[model samples]
Target: MAAKKPWRIIPRPLLETILNNHAQHHRVPQPLLLHGPRGVGKTTLILQRLLPDWNKGPHLTGYVDFAELMKGNLGTSPGPWASWSTCPQPRLSDCRKILEHCVESMVEKGVSAGTITSQQIFTTLNKWHGLTAALRHVLQSKSRASDRASPAALWERAVFAMSRECTTAEVGRILGFGENEKNGLSFEEASYMKESVAALKLAKKIIALQQGWRANAITHMNRTGLFSRTLTHSCTDWPCLLLEFLSQAAEIDHFQPKLVINNIEVLKHATVNSESTVSGPLYHDSLIWRIIALGANERCLPVILVTSDSYYSYEAFLEFGYMEIFISREVSVEGLLG
Candidate 1:
């Protein structure tokens, strides 16, 4: 990976601490929404700077093009319920197909087709090696797969696909080609087909772990941009799900704090749509918030949030709960980079 350009300015003290804590612990908190005007970089802060800090270890971090995913499902885009329905249930197999085709195309296009007798090519070699290598490594190692498949083995055939620079689009193309390939296909076709199968199997395994079926009622199925009303109905059981997950985590891993969820407006919308109030302030409504309040009351989990601008309603929430230390300042780049 290359060094990224520095951010325009330093991060606020409050943002720094929250991100640090999230990085230190593995759990993402749901109350930390930084709400304000558009230019403040609320989404950029969480999606780019904050979430990367939060996901320090083997945790997977990537954004799905929710707009595209929604459009494909609903035959349109920018609908109120786009994120709710389409975002949750991702077609893992289909995703793999698209990714595989992309890689294949990059490999083939990088060099002249059958130009070199020493390195003659037959098909499109989409340059998606880096991404494919990373993903394959994760699937085989970080997740503890029973079978260990090598990257070299996955890319043995270079007829249509070559081994070269891999971009996001290349990944998509590789999967597409694999799905569209015919039987007795070339190396590229076979590799992509294999990828599709593997992705499906992995998706099934993850879904099974979440619940008995492919769709989980809570966390796995919840989308970030859901309409307040639709989201509330869909995630009505989130409180119980979150509680259950936390309890399970507590039982299995006595490790440090884990995962912090930033940008909690999504949760707020979900709660409001469900016709539930978060209680005492912040206008938060949900079983999870209630649980957090109980914990805060007992001095268990300390809840916090970052804001682009101050909202008196949030101050009221803390006051009603008799909770002190609910606020903090932002941090500088020196503090974060170090």
Candidate 2:
């Protein structure tokens, strides 16, 4: 076969216009969907041109290719839940990795911008890694004598510990508890702290689950009810956890993090064997839906999804009642070749 032509990236003016409008809006902008034919350089233009610009400015950018994520899930065994095993894709772990990577990228940008010190970044990342390992050990331990607590309880305790290190008084101060204060926190401060703590909790949870301990829960599923709850709960909140993390991290007054999800078609196209009896859309209640919700809500950061499949059109998303979630834009490489 002849050598494939060098890929050329076309400037997507319409998509860029949508992104700019969202960035300048007083409220959170709608998520954007870039759909076109295969080999159109949709992924290239964003990764090469757009993301770098965002990173250099006030915004942070994160990119994840769902196709690669699917490939990574192949060698891994599904956890004890037969339902989970029947699903062709392992999404929980994928979400965990994506969140972790995004946070790490954000911190690195903060360090470079002098908003956060390098030492602080290293300390936080190291602590997160250590906590992840410890949580994994606790979950995978076969000996009941080691710890009989449910994984969710253990995770909650871990999150509480990671939130902040302080005495009772310090905790009160962080929460705006003052000696002379009569009433609770002001609305603004209360909202900020609530959001901050929630984000920290979610970050810790994502890291812990990234260890793939849920697979171990399957072995003990029949013996303990907690395992089932833990598995189901974690699986359901992957997207919410990510949105929380992004929202909290981008709490800066002026800047919003830009999230780019590449090859989102994978989520739309994934299917199990026809004989498997799996009902419902492949990703109906999964992270994809949460992403749509985040896109529709004005509270979260901006998200951009790039796909080659025509099936993921605006009308299709509308059928799912996500009409306000994504602004569809088509890009073509043919425009650049000339």
Best candidate according to lDDT: 2
Q: How would you encode candidate 2's per-residue C-alpha lDDT over 155-199 as one tens digit per residue?
A: 545444444442434334434456566535576654444334433
lDDT of 1 by residue, 1-338 (tens): 11132333444666556555544432432323333432455445656665664334333222222223334455554543334433433332333233233322322222111111111111111121122343343345334433454433333322122222233344334344444444455776545544433332232233233332223333222344323432332222322222222222221122222322333333333222222222111323443355455354322222234333233223434544533323222222112221
List per-prediction Cα lDDT, in the order shown.
0.33, 0.49
Query: Using alpha carbons, what is the TM-score of model 2?
Result: 0.51
Span of 10 residues, lowest total lDDT, candidate 1: 115-124
RMSD of 2: 13.4
lDDT of 1: 0.33
Best by TM-score: 2
Which pairs of residues clash in candidate 2, taking residues 3 or more apart in a chain or in different chains? 80-218
Q: Estimate each model's TM-score.
A: 0.33, 0.51
